[model samples]
Target: MTQPEVEPVSPRPSNLNLPNVLTTLRIVLVPFFGAALLVDGGDSGTWRTVAWVIFFVAMATDKIDGDIARARNLVTDFGKIADPIADKAITGMAFIGLSIVGEVWWWVTILVLLREWSVTLLRLSVLKRVVIAAADLGKLKTTVQGLALGLLVLPLLDPDLPSWLETPGEVLFYVAQVLLAVAVALTLWSGAEFYRGVWRQRHELRGSGKS
Candidate 1:
């Protein structure tokens, strides 16, 4: 008896879904955010605040896009690729810009950047065999880092704020400092988690191999 031919599966297209739109929006905002931060070379309070708003909006998309994709079953290969790229672009811009403005130490920025990109590359290496979803600790790290960077970017939070807000702003700045330290620590921890996961799945990954 002759065997029947098997049909090939077609990949799902990454249409203009809400989640993908949000992801694209985040990527698009990266350069604008960088420009707003640097227009006055991080000196002008107005531009600094503008940059903060832009950064907040971009980060908000990060929080929502994943939820929307999962809830609506709108996940796509494009999203899988573009989402992380968008994140890295915006967050990397923030780190580098802060370092430029003297708000963040270069060493801290370098350490976080190295870990983030290195882990991302590691994930890609095993993409065919496994998909690593973001962990709770990773989410927390991002949240803390975003808040910390926002505080650092808000130039008006210092002596420029009204007396009523100045005290609160100063307090928040100090809080941001603590959060940043915690964020860095969490970053390293989550990266360790990723490697541990990969180690645990080594046998499965080897079996899966390449297509």
Candidate 2:
């Protein structure tokens, strides 16, 4: 008699874990950060500084959550989906707020957001067919954007700050501009790379009649 075939079992996804909790916390902070920025009305004051602190903390959670998830083997489908959404929300708020407050140009915000969302949409479209992990270039892009936006969000330009800080802050702002430009370049480049990888995988699957 022939033996019965056994089906492979998938790992059960863990949702309620430390990483997911941190991820949720990051999402929750988004509104408060926006409120602070709006309340400050782009002025260099306590509220504006508070907003930056909120933003920084939120960003920090991103790194911590990912590390904890990987280290603890607590990765889940929910986390995979929620993490990117949270990231987009926080970063999107920063971009839009800066544009509204006349701190950053609208065009730059528009271009960066367009690329960011396009890549995200691509990921969703191919999620079933391929698992494309983030590339080094993608992480680099994120880091650069974080640094650039963090610097821009700071009220270091405020005259109330010490005279010494004003000069350094101005210099940091200029450096942030350069980083932003680099980030935009990497964003477009990495996006193209992702598309190429997806196309190749899809093509292979099609050739093998698995797609």
| lDDT tens per residue, model 1, 157-207 | 545667898878788878888888998999999999988888778867677
Task: Return the clash pairs for model 1, or none.
Answer: none
For model 1 the TM-score comes to 0.87
User: What is the model-wide C-alpha lDDT for candidate 2?
Assistant: 0.87
lDDT of candidates 1 onward, in order: 0.86, 0.87
Candidate 1 CA-lDDT value: 0.86
Using lDDT, give the best candidate's number: 2
lDDT of 2 at 16: 90
Candidate 2 lDDT, 1-211, residue by residue in tens: 9999999986775799999998999899998888888775778567788889999999999999999988878888888888988898899899988888887889989998998888887887788779898999999989999998888788867778888788998888788889878887888999899889899998999999999
- The TM-scores of all predictions, comma-separated, are 0.87, 0.91
